[model samples]
Target: MLLKRLQPMMFQARRNYVELMFQVMGRALQAISDVDEPTREEVRALPEGFLFEMQVMPNGPKLIVEHTGDGKLHFHGDTAPRPVDLSIQFKHMAHAFLVLSFQEKTSVAFANDRMLVDGDVSYAVRMTRVLNRLESFILPKLVAQRAVKEYPADIHLPEKLMSSARIYLKVATQFVETVRA
Candidate 1:
Protein backbone atom coordinates (compact mmCIF):
# COMPACT_ATOMS: atom_id res chain seq x y z
CA MET A 1 0.00 0.00 0.00
CA LEU A 2 2.77 2.42 0.94
CA LEU A 3 4.79 1.37 -2.10
CA LYS A 4 1.93 2.18 -4.45
CA ARG A 5 1.37 5.56 -2.81
CA LEU A 6 5.04 6.42 -2.99
CA GLN A 7 5.64 5.38 -6.59
CA PRO A 8 4.12 8.46 -8.20
CA MET A 9 5.82 10.75 -5.76
CA MET A 10 9.12 9.06 -6.40
CA PHE A 11 8.69 9.52 -10.13
CA GLN A 12 7.86 13.17 -9.70
CA ALA A 13 10.85 13.62 -7.43
CA ARG A 14 13.13 12.14 -10.02
CA ARG A 15 11.62 14.37 -12.67
CA ASN A 16 12.22 17.40 -10.51
CA TYR A 17 15.76 16.31 -9.82
CA VAL A 18 16.43 15.86 -13.53
CA GLU A 19 15.05 19.34 -14.18
CA LEU A 20 17.41 20.80 -11.60
CA MET A 21 20.39 18.98 -13.11
CA PHE A 22 19.47 20.26 -16.57
CA GLN A 23 19.47 23.83 -15.31
CA VAL A 24 22.82 23.28 -13.62
CA MET A 25 24.28 21.65 -16.72
CA GLY A 26 23.11 24.56 -18.83
CA ARG A 27 24.74 27.11 -16.55
CA ALA A 28 27.89 25.07 -16.12
CA LEU A 29 28.35 24.88 -19.86
CA GLN A 30 28.03 28.64 -20.18
CA ALA A 31 30.33 29.26 -17.23
CA ILE A 32 32.93 26.86 -18.57
CA SER A 33 32.85 28.38 -22.04
CA ASP A 34 33.83 31.70 -20.54
CA VAL A 35 36.63 30.38 -18.32
CA ASP A 36 37.94 27.32 -20.16
CA GLU A 37 39.59 27.76 -23.53
CA PRO A 38 39.15 24.13 -24.55
CA THR A 39 35.44 24.21 -23.72
CA ARG A 40 35.14 27.42 -25.72
CA GLU A 41 36.80 25.73 -28.68
CA GLU A 42 34.31 22.87 -28.46
CA VAL A 43 31.39 25.32 -28.34
CA ARG A 44 32.84 27.02 -31.42
CA ALA A 45 32.59 23.76 -33.34
CA LEU A 46 28.83 24.21 -33.58
CA PRO A 47 27.79 26.57 -36.33
CA GLU A 48 26.30 29.90 -35.41
CA GLY A 49 22.68 29.55 -34.23
CA PHE A 50 22.76 25.75 -34.15
CA LEU A 51 20.41 24.30 -31.56
CA PHE A 52 20.49 20.96 -29.81
CA GLU A 53 18.22 19.53 -27.18
CA MET A 54 18.41 16.78 -24.55
CA GLN A 55 15.02 15.64 -23.38
CA VAL A 56 13.08 12.91 -21.65
CA MET A 57 10.50 11.18 -23.83
CA PRO A 58 6.68 11.57 -23.88
CA ASN A 59 6.85 14.49 -21.44
CA GLY A 60 9.95 16.37 -20.39
CA PRO A 61 12.55 17.87 -18.21
CA LYS A 62 14.22 19.06 -21.35
CA LEU A 63 17.16 21.38 -21.91
CA ILE A 64 17.98 23.08 -25.17
CA VAL A 65 21.20 24.82 -26.14
CA GLU A 66 21.67 27.11 -29.09
CA HIS A 67 25.06 28.16 -30.31
CA THR A 68 24.65 31.89 -30.29
CA GLY A 69 26.35 33.96 -32.97
CA ASP A 70 28.61 35.35 -30.28
CA GLY A 71 30.42 32.00 -30.06
CA LYS A 72 28.75 30.84 -26.88
CA LEU A 73 26.07 28.35 -25.96
CA HIS A 74 22.81 29.67 -24.59
CA PHE A 75 20.57 27.48 -22.48
CA HIS A 76 16.89 27.83 -23.36
CA GLY A 77 15.46 26.31 -20.18
CA ASP A 78 12.82 23.70 -21.00
CA THR A 79 11.14 25.71 -23.73
CA ALA A 80 11.11 24.05 -27.12
CA PRO A 81 12.88 25.83 -29.95
CA ARG A 82 12.04 25.50 -33.59
CA PRO A 83 13.92 23.30 -36.05
CA VAL A 84 16.34 21.80 -33.57
CA ASP A 85 19.59 20.79 -35.29
CA LEU A 86 20.04 17.86 -32.95
CA SER A 87 18.03 16.08 -30.32
CA ILE A 88 18.78 13.36 -27.78
CA GLN A 89 15.72 11.81 -26.25
CA PHE A 90 15.69 9.28 -23.45
CA LYS A 91 13.21 6.45 -23.87
CA HIS A 92 11.84 6.96 -20.40
CA MET A 93 12.05 9.31 -17.45
CA ALA A 94 13.80 6.51 -15.59
CA HIS A 95 16.52 6.49 -18.19
CA ALA A 96 16.83 10.25 -17.96
CA PHE A 97 17.02 9.99 -14.18
CA LEU A 98 19.73 7.37 -14.43
CA VAL A 99 21.91 9.43 -16.73
CA LEU A 100 21.24 12.88 -15.27
CA SER A 101 21.68 11.69 -11.69
CA PHE A 102 25.16 10.48 -12.61
CA GLN A 103 24.19 6.93 -11.70
CA GLU A 104 25.05 5.96 -15.26
CA LYS A 105 27.40 7.57 -17.71
CA THR A 106 25.77 9.00 -20.84
CA SER A 107 27.87 6.99 -23.26
CA VAL A 108 27.02 3.82 -21.39
CA ALA A 109 23.34 4.69 -21.35
CA PHE A 110 23.40 5.39 -25.08
CA ALA A 111 25.33 2.21 -25.78
CA ASN A 112 22.77 0.32 -23.77
CA ASP A 113 20.04 1.80 -26.03
CA ARG A 114 18.40 3.94 -23.42
CA MET A 115 18.05 6.97 -25.65
CA LEU A 116 17.62 8.00 -29.25
CA VAL A 117 19.33 10.90 -30.97
CA ASP A 118 18.30 12.55 -34.21
CA GLY A 119 20.65 14.87 -36.06
CA ASP A 120 24.07 15.08 -37.60
CA VAL A 121 26.44 12.56 -36.07
CA SER A 122 29.34 14.98 -36.12
CA TYR A 123 27.40 17.59 -34.19
CA ALA A 124 26.42 14.97 -31.63
CA VAL A 125 30.05 14.03 -31.24
CA ARG A 126 30.98 17.66 -30.76
CA MET A 127 28.25 18.08 -28.19
CA THR A 128 29.47 14.99 -26.37
CA ARG A 129 32.94 16.47 -26.19
CA VAL A 130 31.53 19.72 -24.89
CA LEU A 131 29.57 17.85 -22.21
CA ASN A 132 32.60 15.80 -21.27
CA ARG A 133 34.69 18.93 -20.91
CA LEU A 134 32.06 20.65 -18.85
CA GLU A 135 31.60 17.57 -16.69
CA SER A 136 35.32 17.52 -15.96
CA PHE A 137 35.10 21.09 -14.80
CA ILE A 138 31.83 20.90 -12.87
CA LEU A 139 31.97 17.50 -11.16
CA PRO A 140 34.32 16.21 -8.51
CA LYS A 141 36.75 13.56 -9.74
CA LEU A 142 34.95 10.83 -7.80
CA VAL A 143 31.50 11.75 -9.08
CA ALA A 144 32.91 12.52 -12.50
CA GLN A 145 34.45 9.09 -12.72
CA ARG A 146 30.93 7.70 -12.59
CA ALA A 147 29.26 10.44 -14.64
CA VAL A 148 31.76 10.37 -17.47
CA LYS A 149 33.13 7.24 -19.08
CA GLU A 150 36.71 8.13 -18.15
CA TYR A 151 37.82 10.80 -15.76
CA PRO A 152 40.63 12.81 -17.36
CA ALA A 153 44.03 11.78 -16.05
CA ASP A 154 45.70 15.02 -17.10
CA ILE A 155 43.42 17.24 -15.00
CA HIS A 156 45.44 18.73 -12.17
CA LEU A 157 43.55 18.35 -8.90
CA PRO A 158 44.15 21.91 -7.77
CA GLU A 159 43.05 23.36 -11.09
CA LYS A 160 40.01 21.11 -11.23
CA LEU A 161 39.09 22.02 -7.66
CA MET A 162 39.24 25.70 -8.51
CA SER A 163 37.28 25.23 -11.71
CA SER A 164 34.62 23.17 -9.95
CA ALA A 165 34.24 25.81 -7.29
CA ARG A 166 33.69 28.54 -9.86
CA ILE A 167 31.24 26.47 -11.88
CA TYR A 168 29.24 25.54 -8.79
CA LEU A 169 29.13 29.15 -7.65
CA LYS A 170 28.03 30.30 -11.09
CA VAL A 171 25.29 27.73 -11.29
CA ALA A 172 24.09 28.44 -7.76
CA THR A 173 23.94 32.16 -8.46
CA GLN A 174 22.13 31.54 -11.68
CA PHE A 175 19.61 29.39 -9.82
CA VAL A 176 19.01 32.14 -7.29
CA GLU A 177 18.61 34.70 -10.04
CA THR A 178 16.20 32.48 -11.90
CA VAL A 179 14.17 31.99 -8.75
CA ARG A 180 14.03 35.73 -8.22
CA ALA A 181 12.85 36.37 -11.74
Candidate 2:
Protein backbone atom coordinates (compact mmCIF):
# COMPACT_ATOMS: atom_id res chain seq x y z
CA MET A 1 0.00 0.00 0.00
CA LEU A 2 2.77 2.44 0.98
CA LEU A 3 4.84 1.51 -2.10
CA LYS A 4 1.96 2.25 -4.42
CA ARG A 5 1.28 5.60 -2.78
CA LEU A 6 4.95 6.59 -2.94
CA GLN A 7 5.52 5.64 -6.54
CA PRO A 8 3.86 8.69 -8.04
CA MET A 9 5.75 11.06 -5.76
CA MET A 10 9.04 9.41 -6.58
CA PHE A 11 8.32 9.71 -10.27
CA GLN A 12 7.55 13.40 -9.95
CA ALA A 13 10.71 14.04 -7.97
CA ARG A 14 12.83 12.25 -10.54
CA ARG A 15 11.21 14.25 -13.33
CA ASN A 16 11.97 17.50 -11.56
CA TYR A 17 15.59 16.47 -11.01
CA VAL A 18 16.06 15.62 -14.69
CA GLU A 19 14.55 18.92 -15.76
CA LEU A 20 17.02 20.77 -13.57
CA MET A 21 19.94 18.76 -14.92
CA PHE A 22 18.96 19.62 -18.49
CA GLN A 23 18.82 23.31 -17.76
CA VAL A 24 22.17 23.38 -15.98
CA MET A 25 23.93 21.24 -18.55
CA GLY A 26 22.61 23.37 -21.40
CA ARG A 27 23.94 26.56 -19.83
CA ALA A 28 27.30 25.07 -18.95
CA LEU A 29 27.76 23.65 -22.42
CA GLN A 30 26.94 27.02 -23.89
CA ALA A 31 29.48 28.71 -21.70
CA ILE A 32 32.17 26.19 -22.53
CA SER A 33 31.39 26.25 -26.24
CA ASP A 34 31.58 30.01 -26.31
CA VAL A 35 35.02 30.43 -24.78
CA ASP A 36 37.11 27.30 -25.25
CA GLU A 37 39.29 27.76 -28.30
CA PRO A 38 40.71 24.23 -28.15
CA THR A 39 37.24 22.78 -28.02
CA ARG A 40 36.30 24.83 -31.05
CA GLU A 41 39.29 23.47 -32.89
CA GLU A 42 38.33 19.96 -31.91
CA VAL A 43 34.85 20.54 -33.32
CA ARG A 44 36.31 21.53 -36.69
CA ALA A 45 36.52 17.87 -37.60
CA LEU A 46 32.72 17.79 -37.77
CA PRO A 47 31.05 18.55 -41.06
CA GLU A 48 30.57 22.18 -42.02
CA GLY A 49 26.89 22.27 -41.10
CA PHE A 50 26.58 19.49 -38.59
CA LEU A 51 24.11 19.49 -35.77
CA PHE A 52 24.77 17.54 -32.59
CA GLU A 53 22.35 16.78 -29.84
CA MET A 54 22.65 15.35 -26.36
CA GLN A 55 19.28 14.16 -25.21
CA VAL A 56 17.67 12.09 -22.50
CA MET A 57 14.98 9.57 -23.34
CA PRO A 58 11.40 9.22 -22.10
CA ASN A 59 10.66 12.83 -23.14
CA GLY A 60 13.31 14.26 -20.91
CA PRO A 61 15.50 17.31 -21.63
CA LYS A 62 17.77 17.86 -24.64
CA LEU A 63 20.53 20.25 -25.78
CA ILE A 64 21.65 20.98 -29.32
CA VAL A 65 24.93 22.36 -30.67
CA GLU A 66 25.69 23.36 -34.21
CA HIS A 67 29.16 22.80 -35.68
CA THR A 68 29.66 26.46 -36.52
CA GLY A 69 32.60 28.01 -34.70
CA ASP A 70 30.35 30.48 -32.95
CA GLY A 71 27.57 28.04 -32.21
CA LYS A 72 26.22 28.14 -28.69
CA LEU A 73 24.27 25.47 -26.92
CA HIS A 74 20.49 25.52 -27.41
CA PHE A 75 17.84 23.90 -25.32
CA HIS A 76 15.17 21.69 -26.90
CA GLY A 77 12.74 24.41 -27.99
CA ASP A 78 15.50 26.47 -29.59
CA THR A 79 17.03 23.80 -31.87
CA ALA A 80 17.52 24.50 -35.57
CA PRO A 81 14.98 23.23 -38.06
CA ARG A 82 17.37 20.74 -39.62
CA PRO A 83 18.39 17.14 -39.38
CA VAL A 84 20.95 16.18 -36.77
CA ASP A 85 24.28 14.79 -37.92
CA LEU A 86 25.01 13.14 -34.62
CA SER A 87 23.19 12.54 -31.41
CA ILE A 88 24.15 11.10 -28.04
CA GLN A 89 21.16 9.94 -26.11
CA PHE A 90 21.05 8.77 -22.53
CA LYS A 91 18.87 5.77 -21.86
CA HIS A 92 17.01 7.72 -19.20
CA MET A 93 17.08 10.90 -17.17
CA ALA A 94 18.98 9.25 -14.35
CA HIS A 95 21.75 8.23 -16.71
CA ALA A 96 21.81 11.69 -18.26
CA PHE A 97 22.27 13.41 -14.93
CA LEU A 98 24.77 10.86 -13.78
CA VAL A 99 27.02 11.61 -16.73
CA LEU A 100 26.37 15.34 -16.72
CA SER A 101 27.12 15.61 -13.03
CA PHE A 102 30.47 13.85 -13.59
CA GLN A 103 29.45 10.92 -11.45
CA GLU A 104 30.03 8.82 -14.58
CA LYS A 105 32.25 9.45 -17.58
CA THR A 106 30.49 9.72 -20.92
CA SER A 107 32.61 6.98 -22.42
CA VAL A 108 31.99 4.73 -19.47
CA ALA A 109 28.25 5.31 -19.69
CA PHE A 110 28.30 4.41 -23.38
CA ALA A 111 30.29 1.26 -22.63
CA ASN A 112 27.78 0.35 -19.93
CA ASP A 113 24.88 0.58 -22.37
CA ARG A 114 23.49 3.61 -20.64
CA MET A 115 23.85 5.74 -23.77
CA LEU A 116 23.00 5.55 -27.45
CA VAL A 117 24.82 7.21 -30.32
CA ASP A 118 23.64 8.13 -33.79
CA GLY A 119 26.56 9.32 -35.85
CA ASP A 120 29.75 8.39 -37.62
CA VAL A 121 32.34 6.73 -35.43
CA SER A 122 35.14 9.21 -36.17
CA TYR A 123 32.97 12.27 -35.64
CA ALA A 124 31.75 10.82 -32.38
CA VAL A 125 35.33 10.34 -31.25
CA ARG A 126 36.12 13.97 -31.96
CA MET A 127 33.03 15.06 -30.13
CA THR A 128 34.11 13.02 -27.16
CA ARG A 129 37.42 14.87 -27.15
CA VAL A 130 35.61 18.19 -27.13
CA LEU A 131 33.46 17.07 -24.23
CA ASN A 132 36.53 15.89 -22.36
CA ARG A 133 38.23 19.25 -22.87
CA LEU A 134 35.12 21.03 -21.64
CA GLU A 135 35.01 18.80 -18.59
CA SER A 136 38.64 19.62 -17.80
CA PHE A 137 37.85 23.31 -17.91
CA ILE A 138 34.58 23.22 -16.02
CA LEU A 139 35.44 20.78 -13.25
CA PRO A 140 38.03 21.13 -10.52
CA LYS A 141 41.18 19.04 -10.89
CA LEU A 142 40.31 16.68 -8.10
CA VAL A 143 36.80 16.04 -9.34
CA ALA A 144 37.87 15.93 -12.99
CA GLN A 145 40.47 13.32 -12.16
CA ARG A 146 37.71 10.95 -11.21
CA ALA A 147 35.58 11.79 -14.26
CA VAL A 148 38.26 11.43 -16.95
CA LYS A 149 40.30 8.40 -17.87
CA GLU A 150 43.50 10.41 -17.57
CA TYR A 151 43.98 14.02 -16.62
CA PRO A 152 47.00 15.50 -18.40
CA ALA A 153 50.07 15.67 -16.19
CA ASP A 154 51.88 18.39 -18.15
CA ILE A 155 49.38 21.10 -17.19
CA HIS A 156 51.19 22.63 -14.26
CA LEU A 157 49.67 24.98 -11.70
CA PRO A 158 50.55 28.21 -13.45
CA GLU A 159 49.08 27.26 -16.79
CA LYS A 160 46.06 25.72 -15.20
CA LEU A 161 45.40 28.83 -13.15
CA MET A 162 45.81 31.13 -16.13
CA SER A 163 43.53 29.09 -18.38
CA SER A 164 40.95 28.72 -15.65
CA ALA A 165 40.85 32.47 -15.12
CA ARG A 166 40.45 33.14 -18.81
CA ILE A 167 37.72 30.53 -19.17
CA TYR A 168 35.78 31.94 -16.22
CA LEU A 169 36.02 35.48 -17.55
CA LYS A 170 34.77 34.45 -20.93
CA VAL A 171 31.97 32.34 -19.50
CA ALA A 172 30.83 35.27 -17.39
CA THR A 173 30.83 37.58 -20.38
CA GLN A 174 28.92 35.04 -22.42
CA PHE A 175 26.34 34.73 -19.71
CA VAL A 176 25.80 38.45 -19.69
CA GLU A 177 25.45 38.57 -23.46
CA THR A 178 22.95 35.72 -23.39
CA VAL A 179 20.91 37.48 -20.75
CA ARG A 180 20.92 40.75 -22.65
CA ALA A 181 19.84 39.00 -25.81
Measured by lDDT, the strongest candidate is 1
Q: How many Å off is the CA of 96 in candidate 2?
A: 1.2
> Local distance difference test, per candidate?
0.84, 0.70
Error of 1 at 96 (Å): 0.8
Q: Name model 2 segments beyond 4 Å from true.
A: 1-24, 27-34, 70-78, 178-181
Model 1, stretches more than 4 Å misplaced? none
Q: lDDT tens digits, residues 1-181, model 2?
A: 9999998987778667766655555555555666656666676666667877777785676767676544444334336569888888889877876776678888789899999889887887887776676667667898877677678676677766766676667656655776898
Clashing pairs in 1: none
Instruction: In angstroms, give how far residue 159 of model 1 lies from its true place.
Output: 1.4
Q: Give the alpha carbon lDDT tens digit for every residue of 1-181 in model 1.
A: 9999999999999999988888888888777776777777887878998988989887788888888855588778877567899998999999999988889999999999999989998998889888987887777778888988777777898888888888788778878888899
Name the top TM-score candidate.
1
| Each prediction's TM-score versus the true structure | 0.93, 0.77
Tell me the deviation in Å of residue 163 in model 2.
2.9
Model 1, residue 108: what's the lDDT? Answer: 94
